[model samples]
Target: MYALVDCNNFYASCERLFRPDLQGRPIVVLSNNDGCVVARSAEAKRLGIKMAVPLFQVQEQIDRENIAVFSSNYALYGDISARVMTVLEQQAPAIEVYSIDEAFLDLNGLETNFPLVEYGLQLKQRVYQYTGIHVSVGIAPTKTLAKLANHAAKQYPATRGVVDLSDPLRQRRLLGLLPVQEVWGVGRRLSRRLNQQGVSSALALADCDAAWIRSHYSVTLERTVRELNGQPCMALEECPPPRQQILCSRSFARRITEYRDMRSAIAQYCSRAAEKLRQQGGLARVVTVFIRTNPHSQLETFYSHSASRMLSIPSADSRLLSATAHALLQSIWKPGFRYMKAGIMLSDLYPSGSFQPTLFDAPESPAAMRLMQAVDNINRSGRGQVRFASEMLSSGWQMQRNRLSPAYTTRWDQLPVVRA
Candidate 1:
């Protein structure tokens, strides 16, 4: 059996973890730069606050309905996720960290001995005890069914945050009731296509011929069908490989007009991206920088642009890539436009140590490696931030409009104090 364990309204739950006073209240978490609603609590959802609704558009609703809003506190969320995963790892034989707030646990051998449903309740209780975040666990013979079961667990309070769809008849009946688009890997386009073909339910899609699906729809659809039919095509991966591309981009809380400010923002993003690349043992050959104006602004002269600069040599080094990124920004940035968002993307990645050394640009030296280690260690220990140029601080190139909660689990200073 495969079990999918997902946190209940993760960001909102994280906010609730420390501030138990906000229990059962309407709450929503904003995206980067407090732009839009990225996460909503059940109470907030009950008020019909749609996900991704612009913060400005919902400001009236918030004020009128007395909705609580919070900034995305990733530090707290990550720490809570770590605690949840750690507790789950101890309980399950093997656990796959699927996302920030989701995981898959293999429950193959416990059907006869320990009941899966009871195990799920225990999982939930343990997770809550460890981190004060409620989670729902769904069990099925296949990953796709497990995902659907998880959704059911989240919606149906009767399940008590645990649902198992391992029975064949139950799986079929459940799929028949669910919309085709709700199936795993089915997006809007594919859902529309399936609807056109008169396949309006997940069961209907699963009943489609695999050959026809492979021909018309994608191989992905076929895989989904197989998974729905209790074939686990995708195996659980314990530690997935690092991402091929690293991006750090955000809309500014306010528009930026000056060239120096834009340059500084781009530099900070590049530096952050480079640090991530190096941490993952990857190097990027292409550096992309982009700046744009807000689309919703009344100002008519709207403009947005991006430029990619090919690196002289693939590098994970912050100093080298950041310099190249600054040069790219110079080409793409246009004066007089009030830019709202700027970002950096490092792509065409390769393993840091496996890069072919070029005659023109040599690889990093031993001394450079040691310096990087020292920088990473100091930053990890919180003595200082990963800094290169003083312009980063001077230009206010940091997370914007952040009204974040304390890092209750991650930071020592921010941890909750227990009364003696």
Candidate 2:
């Protein structure tokens, strides 16, 4: 058996975790630079504030409805996610972290007569008690069905955020009611094509001949068909594969016109990308930088360019990556255009110490590695605690987060106080 546990309105719930007074209020969390809605509470959904809609487009509605808006507080969200995962780790025999707000648990080896739904309810309650984040749990014989059950738990309040699809009859009934897109692997486009083929619901897809699906569509979709029939086609990935490339990019709060500001932004992005590379114990052979004017801005001339440089030897050192990225930025930087966004990409990644270095190639020094490790350690304790001199200390190109909440869990100064 497998179980999927997913947080409810994760970002908004994280915001409400500390703000009890804001419970039941319409809330929404914005993307980077307060650009668009990324997460919304149930009340906000009820108000018809669609996801990913520009904040400016809904500003009047928000003001009229007394909606609570927040900039993405990633530090707080990450900390809370860690706490929730900790609770799950203690409860489950083995688990796979599917995302920041979702995980899959292995429920095999339990007593056959064990109450799965009751166990799921207890697990949900434990996570809420420990992390103050409500979660929905779905248990089933297959991972795909588990995901479907989790969706059902979220959609129907009568389930009380717990759904078990162990029975074939119950799975069939729910699958009949759900659209084909609600199936685990079927997406919007695929669902549309399936709908045209008379497979409009999960039950219909499950009823399709697996051999015919594989011949007509893809082997992957065939697996989805089998999984929908309560056969396990996908196994839990306890350890996710390492990424081949790391990218750090963001749109600026305002347009940048100066060369120095662009340099600072690229350096900062490269530093972040290097940190991720080191975290994954990987080294990059190529560093690329890109800058662009707002494509949506009619007043400014559109300009976008990127340049990449191959390193003599693969390395994850922040100084080396930042220097390479800055050089790439210099090569691509245009003078007149007002740049709205910039980013750094590190590619051709290899596991650290795995690549062979020639005599002419200059490998990263032990001293440099130690310094970077120290810097990462400090930053991990609290982000931006230590940064490269090239990274701007304070700059106008920084993201606009006017409505950001305090880092309640990560920062000592921002920690909530009890008056009692």
Candidate 3:
């Protein structure tokens, strides 16, 4: 058996963790710069505050309903998520971290001794008692069906936050009730096509011939069909696959109009992206930079553009990536438009030691490697004290996290104090 564990309203729960006063109240967590609604509590959802709606549009509702709002405090959320995962890591034999707030755990042999439902409840309660965050557990024979079971656990309160699809009869009954779009790997477009073909329910799609699915749709869809039919097509991936591409992007706290400000933002993003490449021991042959005005804003003139360049040799050096990214920015940036967001993408990556060196390319030097290591260690221990001179010095174009909570777990100064 495979089990999927998912946090309930993760971001909102993170916000509520420190502020127990806001419990059972309408609370929301905003995107970068407090722009749009990224997370909402059950109370906030009852008020009909739709996801991705701009903060300005919901001001009246917020005021009338006395809703509490918070900016995205990623530092706090990440620390909390790590703690939750640590608890699961201690309990499960093998696990795959699917996302920031979700994971898949292996439960094949353990179920032979105890009931699966009891194990799910134990996992759920242990997580809550340890991290103070509620989670739902779903168990099934396959990862895809486990995902479906998790959906059922969250959707229906009658399940009491745990669902087991190990039984074939329950699988057929539940899949019949769920729409085709709700099935794992069936996106909007594919679901629409399936609906048109009279496969409007998960059971209908599961009943389709495997060969016909492979011929008409894809091998991936055929696997999904098999999974829904109680066949284990997907296995528990204990480790994440290596990323082919790495992207770092964020909306600015304020609009930037000057070339120097845009230069700083691009360099910071590239430097961050390069650090990631080095962490993975990978080198990128291509670097791309993009900038754009806020589409939600009603500007006199709106514009968005991007530029990419292939390097002569694959490299993960921060200085080299930052220089190339700044040059790309100069080529695409327009003077008059106020740019609200920017990003850097590194692709065409190869393992650090596997790439062949070109005749004219500079070989990797020990001095350079040592310097990069020192920089990474210093920055990891102490935040951003050692960086390229080209990177931003002041708070010029950082994200606006005005209502951010303190990093209670990670930062020493921000740690909560107990008073007698």
Candidate 4:
């Protein structure tokens, strides 16, 4: 058996974890630079604040309706996600951290001894007790059905955050009612095609001929069908290898027209990417820097620009990557255009200490390697920031004015008060 565990209204829930007063209020979390609505609380959804609605388009509604809005704080979200995964690992036999707000657990051994429905609710209650974040759980014989059951648990309040699809009648009733697009692997185009074929629900698609699906929609669709029918086509994979590419990008809170600000932004992005690379035990041979004007603004002259540079050595060192990224920024930064976003992309990644030095390239010297390690250690210990030459700007390119709630769980100064 498999179990799917998903956080409810993840970003909004993370915000609520700190600001308990905001509970039951209409809150929406914005995407980068407060561009659009990314996540909303149940109250916000009730107010017709649709996901991805631009802030400008909804400004009047937000103000009139008294909608509480927040900028995305990934630092806080990442910390909370780590905590959630830690709790799950302690409780589940095996867990696959699927995303920032979802995981899959192997519940095969426990199913025979315990009632699956009861077990799912116990997991939810324990998670809530530990994290103060609500979660929904679904247990089924296969991953696809587990995913479907999870959707059902999230949708219908009667389930009370737990759903099991092991019963044949329950599985059939749920599948018959689920929309085509609600299936695990079905996308917009596939849903339209499925509807055209009169297979408008999950049960109808699952009953379709496997050969026709394989011939028309490819082998992947066939596998999804088989998985829906209690065969596990996808195995639970944990601790996959580090990524081949890492990208760090964000739109500015306000458009930047100054060269120095652009430089600072690109440098900061590269510094962040390098930190992630080191954390993943990977080094990059190339860094690509890009800057652009807002694509959505009519008054803004459209400008999308990027440049890539080869590193002297494949390195996860922040200083080296920041230097290269700044050089590329100098070549691309324009004076008059109000730049919307800047970013860094690291590619041709390999595990650190595994790559051989190229004949034409100079390897990182012993002194430089030691300095990098020292910087990383200092930053990790929170003694100071690990910064590079390009990040030496006094304060330009800092995340635009953040009126954020305190980091109640992650920061000492921001801890909540409790009565003894």
Candidate 5:
């Protein structure tokens, strides 16, 4: 058996963790730059505020309903997620972290004779007790079914936030009720195609022959079909594979017209991407920088361009990456375009110390590696404490987080105070 544990309204829950006054109130967490609604509390969902709706579209409703609004506080949310994952790590024999707000726990030996539902309930209670965040638990014979069980647990209040679909009959019954889109791997486009083909429900898709599904759709979809039939096609990955490329990009709060601002943004992005590459013990051989104007703006001309430079040797040193990124930005940047977004991509990656150097190639310096390690250690202790000089301290292109909450758990000064 496998169990999927998912945090309920994760971003909103994190916001309410330190603010008890916000409990039972409608809350919505905005995306980067406070552009649109990314997460909504259950209360907010009940008010018919759709996901991804622009803030301006619901401004009147927000004011009239007195809804609590917040900009994304990733630091607090990441810290809380770590706490929740820590609790699961201690309890489960083996685990797969699916996302920031979800994980899959292996229960093969643990649930031999013990009641799965009871075990799930215990997990749910422990997570809430330790982290003060509510989670729904779904237990099943396969990961896909476990995901479906979790969906049912969240959609129905009577499940008490725990559902077990280990029984084949129960799995079929629930599958019949759920739309094909609700299946783990089936996305909107696939679901639409399935609906057109009369495979509108999970049960219908599962009933189709796996070979036919593979021939009609893909091998991946076939695996999903097999999983829905209680056959586990995918195994839990304790350690996910390393990324082949590291991309650091963001949409700006406003259009950037000056070359210096664009250079600052790209430099910061390169520093971030290089940090990630080093964290994974990898070095990048190619650096790419891209800048683009807003595609939706009617007044501004749409412009987008990107350029890549091959490094002399694969390196994870942020200084080298930032310098290359800046040169790439200079090569592609247009003077008059009001650039709205820029990013850095590090590709052609190889494991650190694994690349063979040719006679003509200069090897990466050990001193440079040590310096980067020191910088990473300091930044990890406290972000932005040891940024490079090229990265701007303050810039107009920075994301607008006017409604951001304090870092309740990660920062010493931002911790909540209890008043009697």
Candidate 6:
């Protein structure tokens, strides 16, 4: 059997973990720069606050309902996700971290006289007790079927946030009710196409001939069809794949026309991207920089451009990447336009120590490597003091996070308070 464990309202739950006062409030976490609604609590959903709705569009309801708003804090959310994944790693013999908010657990080998449903409940309780984050568990025979079970768990209150599809009758009934689009790997376009072909529900698609489906679509959809029929084609990946590309980007709180600010933003982006690269132990040969004026703003001239540069040799050194990104930014940057966002992209990544060095290009110095490693370590400890000279002293382009809670877990000063 397989189990899909997913955190419920992950971003909002993370926010609420710190602020208990927001337990029953209409909480909505915004996207980069507090621009749009990304995650909303169940209460917020009742208010018809759709995901990706701009804050300005919902400001009236936000003020009227006293909605608790927050800007996206990737740092805090990332830390919380790590904590949750740690708990899962401790419990599950094998786990595939499907996303920051979800994972797949292999439950085949465990000898439990207790019911699997009871075991799933226990796993859920342990995660909640340890991290104070609520998660739903769905157990099934296949990965795709496990996803449907998870969906049912979320949709029906009777499931109590846990569903088991080991029963054939339950599996059949659930598949009959589930729309094709709701099935894993079936998007809107594919669902519409399937609907045209009389494949309306998951049951219908599962009943379709696998060879016929393979002829029409690809092997992946065929596999999904089989998986929906209680066959497990996709195996749980115990280790997630290394990211093929690293991108660091964010929208500024306010539009700026200054080239210096753009330079600073690009450098910061490159620095952060380099940090991720080193964490993954990968080196990049291609660096791309891009900037754009807000297309949604009628007052600003719409301009967007991107420039890419190939490094003479692949490197993960922050200073070198920052310099390359800055030069690329300068080439694409234009004056008299209000720039809303800028980003850095590193691609063609190779393993850090095994990559071939270019003939004419110099490899990173031993001292530079040691310095960056130490810098990463210091920053990991919550002291973000090590930064490039070209980088701004403060994030002038920082997102608007007026309602953000403190870094309760990561920062010493922001640790939770408890009464004895």
Top of the candidates by lDDT: 5
TM-score of 6: 0.95
lDDT of 1: 0.86
Best by TM-score: 5
Which model is ahead, 3 or 5, in terms of TM-score?
5
- Flag the better candidate by TM-score, 1 or 4: 1
Candidate 4 residue pairs in backbone clash = none
Give TM per candidate. Answer: 0.93, 0.97, 0.94, 0.92, 0.98, 0.95
Comparison by lDDT, 2 against 5, better one: 5
* CA error at residue 156 for candidate 6, angstroms: 2.0
Give the per-residue lDDT digits (tens) of candidate 3, residues 311-401: 8888888887888998899899899888888999999999887878878787677677678878888877734568677776545798888
lDDT of 4 by residue, 1-420 (tens): 999999999989998886767877899898866778999999999889999988899999989988888888877888888888898998778889999999999887897788988988888988889998899998898899999999999889999989999887798899999998999989999999999999999999889888899998899999999888888888887776688899998777777888877777777788778878878888899999988998998987899889998776788877778878888888887788988788899999988678887798677676766777787788876445767666776355566635466666666776789769
Clashing pairs in 6: none
**Superposition TM-score, candidate 2 onto the true structure:** 0.97
User: Could you tell me the lDDT of residue 21 within candidate 1?
Assistant: 78
Q: Which stretches of candidate 6 lie over 4 Å from their true place?
A: 296-300, 358-362, 418-420
| lDDT ranking, high to low | 5, 2, 3, 6, 1, 4
TM-score winner between 2 and 4, please give it. 2
Off by over 4 Å in 3: 294-304, 382-384
C-alpha lDDT of candidate 4 relative to the true structure: 0.85
- Summed over model 5, clashes come to 0
lDDT of 1 by residue, 1-420 (tens): 999999989999889877767988899999887889999999999999999999999999999988889999987888788888999999878989999999999998988888889999998999998888889999999888999999989878999999988788989988888999999899999899889999999999889888899999788889899999888888888878889899999877667888878878887787778778878888789988888888887855889888898876787777778788888888887888888888999999998777787788867776766777677777777445668772464555456656688877766777798778
